[model samples]
Structures are given as C-alpha cells and as structure tokens.
Target: MVFLHARGITRTVELPDAEPLHILRGVDLDVEVGDHVSIMGRSGSGKSTLLNILGLLDAPTSGTLEFDGVPLDRMTAGRRDRTRGRNVGFVFQQFNLLPRRTALENVEMPLLYDGGRGFWRRRRLAAEMLERVGLGERMAQMPERLSGGEQQRVAIARALVRSPRLILADEPTGALDVETGATIMTLLDQIATQAGAALITITHDPHVAARAQRVFRLSDGVLHAEEPILEPAA
Candidate 1:
C-alpha cells in the first residue's frame, strides 16, 4: 500500500502584496511500508519544505496528496492535525526535548497529546519505548543530564510513543558526533523497521543517503525519482 502519494504538488509563498516565492515545483513521489527513503539536497533546495508537505505538516499550494489512497486536499484542519499526530512521527535535528522534564516524561508527552490512558497506562508504554532504544536506565534523567546520543534516543522514544505509521527525520544526526550519529541511525532503522513503519529521512550528507533503501535528489525545487540502491559501496 502507498502510505504516501504526492501528485504534481507545488507551493508558492507570497509576501506582502509582492510576487510569490516558488518553493516547490510539481513534485511527485510515493512511499510504501517496509521502505526507507533518504531525501538529499543542498540548502535552499527546499528539502525541509518538501518534508513538511510529505508528513502532512503543511499543505501544498496546489496539487493532490493522498495518504493510504485517501485524498488529503479536502481534509479539515482538525482532522489533518489528528491524522498527523496519529500516523506521522517526527525526529528533528535538534533534540527538542523538554529541558526540565525527565526522559520518561518527554517520551510520554506524545501520548498525553493524544489523550492517552491512565497513569499506569502511559508509564508502561513509555517505559517500553525507552527500553527499546536502550534508554531503560536513563528514564528518570533530565534532558541536560543525558549525552547527545542518549538525548536523541529519548526523542525517538517520544516519536514512537503513540506508534505512528511513518517516521520523518530531518537531519536527525546533524548535531551529533560521528560515533553517536552512527549509533542513533542504527537504532532508528531497527526501531522503525520493527514497528513496520516507513521511514523518510532528509539529510545533506552523502553517507547518510547511502544508508537508505532508496535515495532521491531534489534540486531547483524539483524532486527526481531514483532507482533503489542494492547497497552502498564499501
């Protein structure tokens, strides 16, 4: 099934009574379950804008977006908001953790947003997610107390707390050192695959693109389809 399908999607940002700035140009793409895709491009190539549109965080200026074969163009704002939280998980470049909150609290935040169940209910699920990312012992630690990789682990736990169908990660490894980045990517692939969720990652690094099943290059506000990579050359 196509978890995401975009057809001739385009976006143009208009300033105060000025000509519009064209940010996206008739981009079409599709993703399926069990697929891991990496979107790569230079800055100002509209990589992040495209990611936002794909994740349903924003609507295209024009064109159709279908999720699970249902047209999203007609979906109401409230419905779109709920759909995004329920089906799409996001991991940002910055940890974006709550500094004062413990790792467990941060992880459980998503469930709370979705109106999750009783105290024990959320706690059990949060604990399970933390453990899955090897953060069992860091649950009670505050964000500042955790290392870079550990902080990102908490972020991933938070992303998966409500069990989303797709994971959108933009520069998830940007802030970490090489060693930590590798570990984080390893865990990201393992958890997303285990949960049967499609992963769409946007990174500027060639090596990062090499990690995905397929890598698409976007340039001049256009996305070009690409063949699958059997494996990255050693």
Candidate 2:
C-alpha cells in the first residue's frame, strides 16, 4: 500500500515587508511500507521543511499531501493531531530527549499523546521498547548520564515505542562517531523493518544517505531522486 503521497507541495513564509520565501516548491513524492528513503541537501535547502511536511508536523502552504490516501489539509485539527501522533515517529540529530527525564520516562512520552490501551500500559511498553534498543539496563539513566550513541538510542526507542507506520529521521547519526553511527543506523533499520515501517532519512551526509535503499537530492526547494546505490533483494 502507498503509505504517503505528496503532489505539487509548496511551503511559503511571508517575511516582513518582503516577498514570501518559498521553502518547498512543486515537490512530488510517494512512499510505500518498509521503504527506506534518504534525502540529502545542504543546510537551509528546505530539507527539514520537507521532512516536517512529510511527518505531518506542519502543513504545506499549497498542494496536496495524503497519508494513507487521506488528505492532511482537509482534516480537522484534532483529527490531524491524533492521526499524526498515531502514525508518525521522529528521530532527530540532537536526540531531543527530556534532559531531566529518565530513559524510560522519555520513551513513555509518545504514549501520553496516544491515549488508549497502550497509553494505559505505558510503563511496560516503554520498558520493552528501551530493551529492544539494548537500553534495558540504562532505562533509569538520565540523558546526561548516557553517551552520545546511547542518547540517540534512547531517542530511537522513544520514536519506535509507538510502533508508528512512518519513521522520519533527521540527521539521526550526525552526533555520533563513525562506528557508533553505523551501529545505530543498523539497529534503526533492523527495528524499523521488523516493525514494517517506512523510513525517511534526511541528511547532508552522503555516507549516511548511501545506507538507504533509495536516495534523493533536495536543491532549490525541489526533490530529485538519484539512482539507487544499493538495490534490495529481488
């Protein structure tokens, strides 16, 4: 099934007494379940903006974005929030964990937004997720107490705790050493695949982008897919 489809998407921000700044223009893309896509671009090239739109954290200024074929712009605010919380998971370069919260508490954060059976069982679910990321023993440790890789691992666990259908990772390994970064990416890909989630990674690093099955380049607010560097099994 097509997990996400975006067409003619544009994002413009009006500046004070100046022409509107177009962040994304005429972008079109499609993603399927279990697909891994990487988009590479320099800073301020609207890569993050595109990620935001794809993740449903922000709406496009114009054009259509459909998640599971449902128009995002047409959904009510409440419905949009609920759908976003339920289906999208994000891993960031900075880890984005609550500094004061223990690893378990940070991982439990998503469940609060997804109030249902899992939310009621947040502690157990969060622990299981942390364990899945190989952070079971570190569950009680604070973000400051963990190494850079461990912090990112905690962030990954937090992102996956909800078993989101789409995972948006923005420079997920930018903060780690080469070896640690590679290990983290491997762990992320494995867990995401096991969960049957589509993964979209945004980064400026070609090495990082190469890890994905398909790659794209973002320039001048547009996205163009490069030839696949690594083909998946037939």
How many residue pairs clash per model? 0, 0
Models 1 onward score TM values of 0.93, 0.96
lDDT of 1: 0.87
> Which residue pairs does candidate 1 place in steric collision?
none
lDDT of each: 0.87, 0.91
Give the per-residue lDDT digits (tens) of candidate 2, residues 65-143. Answer: 9999899977998898888899999999999899889999999999987658997999999999989989989999999
Angstrom error at residue 174, model 1:
0.5
lDDT of 1 at 81: 88
lDDT of 1 by residue, 145-201 (tens): 899889999999998888889999999999998778878998999988889999999
Candidates in order: C-alpha RMSD to true structure = 1.9, 2.7
- Model 2 clash pairs are none
